[model samples]
Target: MTFSIVARDGDAFGVAVASRFLAVGSVVPNARIGVGAVATQAFARVSLRHELLDALAGGESVETALEQALAADPLREQRQVGLVGCHGARSSTGADCMDWAGGLAGESGDVAYAIQGNILTGPEVVRAMEEAWLTSAGQPLPRRLLGALLAGDAAGGDRRGRQSAALYAVCPGAGYDECGVLADLRVDDHPQAARELARLVELSELYFGGPEDVESLRGDLAEEVQELLDHVGVQGDSVAEALTAWAGEVNLETRLTPAGIDRRVLEELRRTAGR
Candidate 1:
């Protein structure tokens, strides 16, 4: 009843899932850096989420964690599993008795993914998903993930149907400070939920910032920011004050913390660059 991809991008990693079932995220996805990402679906087992995540975190590779988990389950044939780990290791399994269940694994640089599902059209779903992942060059990871999900859907996903969808990820920068989810959201039953969720993620990245996005804006800082602000129309004290308020409310100060000036400085810059 679900199709999902567990992937790692550079220093960031995430799991995206779409299903014709309710609360798929609760059972179908498990992920961590030191460990791996695991998705257990079909009949679905809640315990496997934490158990697999914990086992992966303990330093087990994707294959080992999945083997141990499936080994303990007597009803393994009625299930589907996928996993990916820190060293870019990946593995997937689909029982012959699992009614159309199948999966695929890919390894490329710091990026890797395990795509799988039950009630899916064999490798077609995985192929489409992988194609989207490979073709989405120069795009953000979140966009690539959504593109993969949409490709799977187009190729025939969850033979039973479509309903809820979700996205998840982890970043070390989030530990520093951020007022947002780690890209976790659920579209319980919207027909266009996956697309909608992708749009939300893009919007969030615009107003706030993402972990993978920090580095490009960090170097030779002050001049570049002034140029960007000047280009965006932040002239005059009154307008700059508004910009300052906007930045503060969104906690963007972390990017400009090196400026070391009073809020008035931003306000003046805004006034100078008035639209």
Candidate 2:
């Protein structure tokens, strides 16, 4: 009834999941900035998600962390889990999990990633997920993880149908506030959860993205923004102040750069100002 991908991209780690269950994000996926990521589904032992990350944070390898976590759970046989740590990746499908249940992963390597599912339409689900993950090498970490989840969904994920999905990840100093939170988005309940998850990922990138395209507020750029603000009916004494006020109105203040604006913001202003 669930499929997920857990992966480590450089110093970042994340989980992307979709399931027939309601609010799967609140339970199935877990990750921390400095540790690793874990997805526990099947019977879905939520505690194991934390346990696995805790063990990894305590310096255990992905293999040992998974082994110990499941060993401590009485219903481990009913559980399915995928984990990725600093050194390796591990996946487990319990002997008693429903048919078409299993995982794909490499226990030790530079690429720490795992794909797993249970009650899936067929092995094709995980196969498609693994293929997407392996082939999406140059993309951003969060998008790469979501790519795999979307592939699983496209290949007939969770034979039971979809209700919820999530994309959670962390990296050291990548967040808007420089706090390492890359993304934490979820479709708690949606008919097309995986696709919805993808949409949320795109929105996250727009709102929480960095200042790569921001230009210094001077010369032609400043003049362009002043004209745009006037065209958009945004009023202020200074162009930057007016733009910041407009950004606040549109809930885009997080996208503000140092005395400048993101190019995407300029694009939006242009769209509205008809420039």
Candidate 3:
């Protein structure tokens, strides 16, 4: 009833999952910056997420952590899990899991990934995901992960159909307010959960994403940008103050830069002011 991948891209770790079950995100995905990521499903042992992450943080290999996690569980044959860490990637599909269940793991350079699914349409589903992930080199981690999920969906996702989907990624001190999370977006219940999840990811990028490559504001440019903020009803005594207020209003405080405003933020201010 579920499919998931846990992967490492550079110093970041990410997980993407889809399932016929409701609220799969709450149970399937977990990640920590500088540690690793894990997905537990198909009679998921939710506790394994914490245990596996703990093991990885303590310098255990992905394979070792997985073995320990399974050894500690009496109902191992009913649980499915995939893990990726600095050491590598590993996954397991319990024998007692529903038909059409399996997992795969692979690594290239510093990037490692694992794909697993149970009650899926066929092995082709996971294979397509692996192919997509491998082919998406040089792209952002979230986009590559989402591409894999979409490929699984195209190959025939959860034979039971879609009800929920989630995307999670983490980097050191990359979360909101510098909390160490990168992206955590979910479509808890959607007919086309993967597609909806993609949309939510875009919105998340706008509000929570980091600054992009664009020109910064200063001196005269800063004053002109401030004039736009004032035109948009953002009140402040100075340009920096006004832009900061506007950024807070639009939930884009994270994208503001001390050197000047982020290009995306400036564009948004223009758009909102025009409206």
TM-score of each: 0.76, 0.92, 0.91
Which digits, one per residue and each the tens of the lDDT, describe model 2 over residues 40-94? 8988887887788888889988888888888888899988999988888888999
Q: In what order do the candidates fall by TM-score, top score first?
A: 2, 3, 1
Please give, for residues 165-215, the per-residue lDDT of candidate 1 as tens digits: 887776555422652234665677777666766776765554344223222
For 1-275, candidate 3 gives per-residue lDDT tens digits of 89998899998899999999999999999998889999999999888899999999998888888998898788999989999998789989999999789999998788999999999999999999999999999987888899999999989989999999999999887869877777898889999999999998888778888777545677777777877977887788778888888888889988877776787887788788784
At residue 243, candidate 3 shows an lDDT of 82
Checking candidate 3 for backbone clashes, the offending pairs are none
Tell me, by lDDT, which candidate is best: 3
TM-score winner, 2 or 3 = 2
Residue 154 alpha-carbon offset, candidate 1, angstroms: 2.0
Q: Is candidate 1 or candidate 2 better by lDDT?
A: 2
- Total clashing residue pairs per candidate? 16, 0, 0
Q: Which one is best on TM-score?
A: 2
